[model samples]
Target: MNSLPDLLRLLAVPAFAWVAWRDIATRRVPDRVWLPLLLVAGVALLFEFFTINGSPTRRFFLVRVGLSAGLVVPLSYAFWRLGGFGGADAKAFIVLSVLFPAYPAYRLLEFSFPGVETALGIFSLTIVTNAVLVGIFYPVALAARNALAGEVSLRSFVARPIPAADATTEYGRLLDVGPGRGGLDLDALRMYLRWRGHTLEELRADRSTYRHSRSLPEERNPPGDGAIRTTAA
Candidate 1:
């Protein structure tokens, strides 16, 4: 009951759908599908070219195919770069040159038109629709993900100051330190230092002037009774 053109038209939807599915599942569309799709598009174009009456209409179809190819290739490349679509989608569009040689206008119309203005109008509308749908869906998906995960707090994003070096200091800020290993808090260390007649600010100002510095002394063994030793010059 169905004509050959009608069969081809129906076939185009499944072919494109398969391309989208394969890309979604494996991040790739197989060459088997793309190659046949390209060939089918070429055959469809050839069929349309000879079957249609008037030399002017044939030239129009060819011109539209050229324009659509030119537009779709670069635009698809941009989309691929943005992570919106993959290389397979662009190739699929190129194969569509057979089915929509004139494009947007050709897609909308059941029959060929004398002028290309209708095609241009349809192309513009298609672009606008795709843009709107992508914009709306992407943000909604991101929000849903963030809500499910529970967003990170602002305080967690900032880097805190390093702590001072001292064992006695009970640094609260360094309690749950993970990355750079823990150290004594300057404020807490200063409190401990103050108990021993020195302030933290004073030690920071001049390390060399400490009345009783807690720094470890260099090791120097005393001379043994049976060991040889050299006297200072």
Candidate 2:
């Protein structure tokens, strides 16, 4: 017979994998995706708690799970509030706290270390640590993609001038360039264009026509004065 812990571990693998995939694809995991896992895991833990018949190990396991939930949920919420984590990320960590309060008995690979075992006892910490370690590579990947696409030079990735035309279709804020650099404040540009009765479609269709009309924040002169230039990729 498979032990309760083993069975729970088996179920958690696919659940977490699905959450991970959804998060990658959509950048959001709906509550519907995590609710069932939380419910199932919570019920399983409760059942185990009552049925253990006064075993100290089982009691300790339950206590540890409770403590993990207490710590992880609030900490995740705090991160969400502070804008460090997305709502989906916070919810996923909270749910995983319930699902894997402690490490599984089965190891994916064996590494002998007392500290690892102790860390695994608060399994949610393991998830966060793993996530942070993985996240450290994201900027590198972004830099590589930008370099490959010629959006940025390999030698000076951080100093690359992103195209003003890229602002119309892309989803991020434009980098602020100082006065006299022919750089446009994207928000100000949009507002000025809108005030002059330009539609989004019109601006997108002829990005260059208005590129020279953009006003710098500190100096708004004639239409061509200190106008931002869009570089060709």
Candidate 3:
């Protein structure tokens, strides 16, 4: 009976691993990946409630699961709304809260928390913390790669100045100089210009007209080779 919790915890490991791998490779996790795990977790919780009679552990487990759901669901939704998390990422967090509401005792590196509740009781919080700690290295790795590639000069990397004209688009691709920031805001600019009965070509050709336009930066240079490069714009 004591081993029942351990068994349920062991069952969840592979399912979680599979979801993690799928998310890494494809940036998506299908319903099939988490649904069975959710079902199993539900069954395990019910089994523990009915079969484990000697302690208040079952009620405690229920409370942990409820707290995990209450805390994680709204947090995940908020992250999604803020554009910090995708739909798939939010769902994955919710599924994980159910599958691992508390820590399993049969795992490696067991330790006491002193005054702290066992780390497993707040499993979702640990997951978020671990993710954030791991993610902190990504920008460092990107900077290292850029330095090695010579895309980032040592002076530029160290100084990190706000440039008068950024040569590259937000996606890190080079662009011919025109209206630097305006290029990124082209759609809104286009609608405004069109509303004022001016075509983009007309604006590009007449520097005075381009400068006079509201909510638009003055075009610094003429169109390149008669092409309005809109890919990044």
Candidate 4:
């Protein structure tokens, strides 16, 4: 409870969760988050080093910190380079390397807290492996769901179609409706509609105001252009 690493457990849990939520909402995390975190962690670490004078105790702490940081930081960067991890995610793990360094252990009644640790005893590595397991299982779960609903096959296994009415509220790309495009790509149509601060249903309802390729905010209609096909949007 008194150790810097143990105290940081409180900060690490909620901070990581908040970052995940922010990324989900806006698709990007601010670069500023790491700076303050690294500062506080650096100060605490320096403070702990001077305050602990016992040779064996400091050596044990340094060994764990060295092992955890040595393994986790490089692996996190490698995962990011290999495209398995996002930049924010890799940075988060690197922060975890400093914040944790080893599993934070404490006692409650007859049990140990956290209740999990890897064979190598690096806390950050445990998180990465757990994320990998979840990544593997998640698609299997989705595919099982589709199979039970009789939507079997690779396409349905990977993607489930959302209604056009609901599409405006969700985040995804439109799969091109085969042919009969009438010179309109659904991707371009949605971009133009979004730029105009409107929805597909709105454009569908009043094609007269948004009937041509001229409907895009900064784009002009070319010569001999035909009216936008209603089905195109």
Better of 3 and 4 by TM-score: 4
Name the lDDT value of residue 134 in candidate 2: 72
Could you give the C-alpha RMSD of every candidate to the true structure, in order shown?
21.9, 9.7, 10.6, 7.6
Candidate 4 residue pairs that clash: none
Q: Candidate 4: which stretches are off by over 4 Å?
A: 1-4, 51-53, 174-192, 204-211, 217-233
**Per-residue lDDT of 143-216 in model 3, one digit per residue for the tens?**
67667666675443322322433312112222323555322333334345545555656656776756753636
- Scanning candidate 1 in windows of ten residues, the lowest lDDT window is 224-233
lDDT of 4 by residue, 126-214 (tens): 87778768867877888888888877887664566666676544444455455864333344554555457666788879879787767
Predicted structure 2: lDDT: 0.65
For each candidate in turn, the TM-score is: 0.49, 0.60, 0.56, 0.73
Residue pairs with colliding backbones in model 3 are 103-120
Clashing pairs in 1: 105-119
Candidate 4: residue 217 lDDT (0-100):
65
* Local lDDT at 180 for model 1: 75
TM-score: model 2 vs. ground truth: 0.60
Where does candidate 1 stray beyond 4 Å? Answer: 1-6, 103-137, 152-233
Report residue 67 deviation for candidate 1 (angstroms): 1.1
lDDT per residue for candidate 2 within 56-75, as digits (tens), equals 98878877897888888888
Sort by lDDT, best first.
4, 2, 3, 1
